[model samples]
Target: MNQVNTVVLLHTVLHCHFTSADSIENYLFEHYSASMKPRRNQNELVEIDIAMTIQTVLKVDERFQYISFYGWFEVQWRDEFLMWNETEYQGIKKISVPYQQMWVPDISMYYSEEHIHDLGVHPFVSVTSQGHVTWFPGAKYTVQCYLKVKKFPFDRQKCSIVVAAWQTTDRMQKLVPRARSVNEVKGIAENGEWEFQNFTYEENYDAEFDLTKIVYTLEFQRRYRYFLLCTIMPIVILSVLNSLTFLIPVESGERITYCLTLFLTFTVFLTLFDQTMPRNSIDVPYITVFVSFHLFLCVISTMVSILTISSKRGQECDSRDTQIVPLESQGEDLHLGEVNADGKRSGSSGKNYLRRTLKSILKEVFICKIDTVMLVMNFFFLGSSAFVLVICYIS
Candidate 1:
């Protein structure tokens, strides 16, 4: 077995060198040789610039029947320079290198899983030299895994999504992330669908500077179905009931009773409607218009009932005779009262005859006219109201 000497310099730029014949060192040298080389300085400083380009692919896992994200990254060393240390050792150095922080990539997601599926490599910071290598403890890389849904149907304020980081060891459990946030994308989610907004990073240490395995979860709710059932059904039923008020006979006491009852019923329904809706009068909603029509019908029905009662009373009055007829005695009919004036009649027979004939004819005519008028008015008003109600309801 052979032993090797290794030296590492740690700063904003990490530089390291190894002197050994180890097979692992030879492999690292061959693979990364173009990037890692001997420096020309006296202190044996070997500057190396390491950078990573990440490629992400998302696919629906046919076997698992779930969405999966696959990410691949390649770390390359560029612009390598060789130098010598004071101890006569060869080293590599560079003035500028890609920042380590930029190497960490993160993805936004919405589900929970314990283990990351198809994780290609464990998160680590690595550099290799001949048979000797140094590891940076607690150094990690983070990649954000996210899905951009084109459009989400619903209020964005109420909608939410969750991202979970998981490890391969526990496939069923979700690994929690350090932080999460959300942003609204402009001109997106406008067509009743979800739009991919950028993921917001959180201040929680759990979310900072690291690559982890993760998935995302999405959630939302809609009220179209509920509105159709709860609002439309009741309004339709109530409107139908309102129209039925016309079926009651105008003379029947039930006519007034039904109208008043329906009026109250609709009033209560309107109260409920008001509570459910915001206070706005841009245009009356269909339900509100239906309620108003029914209310109008109830009011008209009540008025008609009152007018009918008044008209019937008027007919009764007109049917009574204004003058009374005198009855004649059977045996004493020939005896007439004495007349004082030369041309005046003393008998009651003539007066009685005149009263009976004239009063009877007048009563009959007056009663007939009153009855006809009442009948015509009732028919016209009720029929007109009925027609109006029908039109409103249908409309």
Candidate 2:
């Protein structure tokens, strides 16, 4: 494998240079100092033109909020000391030089230390007779980024990578994008989780730090079809089941159990996805908030089920009463079972009044109102959840 790599590298060099004169390249660089910037004067500013193209975006870790990708950069700058007449060097136009023997700009990516592994490989530099230097190196880079997952599985994210000259002010090193057409990523390989979207850039000069940073902003759209099976479909199934709990008749004695089961399902799902969500305080995923609201509905549904069961038991006891019989559905009108022959009730009138009051209280408090209330609540909560999701996604 190593022999094949070496042969391929040699072929690439020969194919690009197309000249057999190695002596000309040596003589030009032999007396050159590759440690300092290629400036003719001490105070001259060296302008570095850079164009980067993302060949592939390998991974986007939303939980940890980082992106890993493979790409190459084209860096060009002019050196005053390396220029020579082509006629003096047998018309040699360009030559390859070892990258270590040339001075490269002190540029590094900002917010780049989250991962410690290095992905760059040393590459050769190309120099022309006019002292134009071009360095092309391909490598994989992982950088820190934050997640905006308010819409979650259906979300589009805007991430940025900042590149600037480290420990150098804008006066000594001026960076420029090669061209408007080439500044964006040339092309990208398909990723399973995220689809590549177009990118933009901003070059800002900070007067306080005397630094200029180029911020390349890239957007990624999540592949929501993948999440339909894993996330959205399950929530939908649970929501339907939760709403169906109210339709089960109270006499079947399964309404409370079913409602409680729905509640637990939502709980387990929320716990299962907790690690998948980014730990951000500002943007809470609408999916999370929606599930929480659904869980609250479950609690309400369970409480309604319990009230109906209790109301059924109390009504059965009230109907079997003989001492104080209720003639009205509300249990407000009641009288002694049989008045004595003397035409007066046997029990005290006050005792009869107290029984009427107690029965009326039970009838009014637990009257099995879930049918109407559940119908209205289901619409309210389900509609509100949809509204919340729409607002979050639109914003």
TM-score of each: 0.31, 0.80
Candidate with maximal lDDT: 2
Q: lDDT, candidate 1, residue 294?
A: 63
Minimal lDDT window, size 10, model 1: 149-158
Query: Global CA lDDT of candidate 1, please?
Result: 0.39
- Candidate 1 TM-score to native: 0.31
User: Residues 314-369, candidate 1, lDDT per residue (tens digit)?
Assistant: 54564452333344456755332333335344455655556545865665565445
Per-residue error for 41 in candidate 2, Å, reads 1.7
Model 1 residue 9 lDDT score? 24
